[model samples]
Target: MKPAAHVRKTALPGVGTRYDLNTEAGAHLSVVVHQDGRRIISFHDPEDDDACKDAAALAPAEATALSALLTPDPVAHLHQHLEIDLVTEHIPIGRRSPYAGRTLGATQARTRTGASIVAVLRRTDAFPSPTPDFRLALGDTLVVVGTREGADAVAELINGG
Candidate 1:
């Protein structure tokens, strides 16, 4: 069995958390996850611990793509090729939303915005492929699958446009 590499985690006050790891090849690498969901990957110079040889900043979406590439999950590989054009978003129904007490059919999300509500997350329970008659509630998170624009439209519509 291959031994697990030890990763050191450091807290950067007022900045973010950093995870440092030494590769089997003796290279130093670190990844920082910021408060706003941004990520920075850095390769350190062996001679100078504080010096960075190269660095790359990645947005949340870019980081997700990079993570998928490095993951061994079979399901993750299936959607890698379709990452560019397809987008999956989770939209929350707020307390002030007009559809909070209404049925899913009222939104007409798929017809009007072209986004499909594949699931609804209510507390710890998940309702998959919810029917149009499914009632919406505050704090329910809608799992939507569609283009970016379509997801944005769904958010706007659910929040009373």
Candidate 2:
């Protein structure tokens, strides 16, 4: 059985840091930060409670102070919730990409998207369980198991969008 895909942690200078995040609902997050001492934190909903609370708990003075310390840019949080639906939404991708090249690992992929690729499709053929080495080619469709937006992103990547 293949593992899952998720966001891994990476280091960034000037900006706080970068991390590959996977939402519990299944989605991919590619985060970046600016050199203005600003930090971009992206993660799953369940994992972001503390940060949310911290932000919510900030008083006017505290907010101003924190804003002064950090960049003035608005914090971007991507998630599928009833209140704030920034992105398209979660779309399930049936399985992993059959043709693979520099594709994310199973564990990493799952961590980010919450869906597993149970099968792979190559041309008119289908692979029930694809190995890690499977190289993805252009025009090769991937049946990912994620949210609608996640599926769209995968499709875009495959279609060179």
Query: TM-scores of the models, in the given order?
Result: 0.53, 0.30
**Per-residue alpha-carbon lDDT of candidate 2 for residues 1-161, written as tens digits (9 for 90 to 100):** 34565657667765645656565665545444445434444433454533422212333333334555655334444232356423322222323533245453532444545545555655456666556666544434345665666655555544434
lDDT of 2 at 30: 43
Where model 2 places Cα greater than 4 Å from the true spot, the runs are: 1-100, 103-108, 156-161
Which pairs in model 1 have colliding backbones? Answer: none
lDDT of each: 0.89, 0.47
Best by lDDT: 1
lDDT of 1 by residue, 15-54 (tens): 8999999888989999999988899999998767699999
State which candidate has the highest TM-score.
Answer: 1
TM-score computed on alpha carbons, candidate 2: 0.30
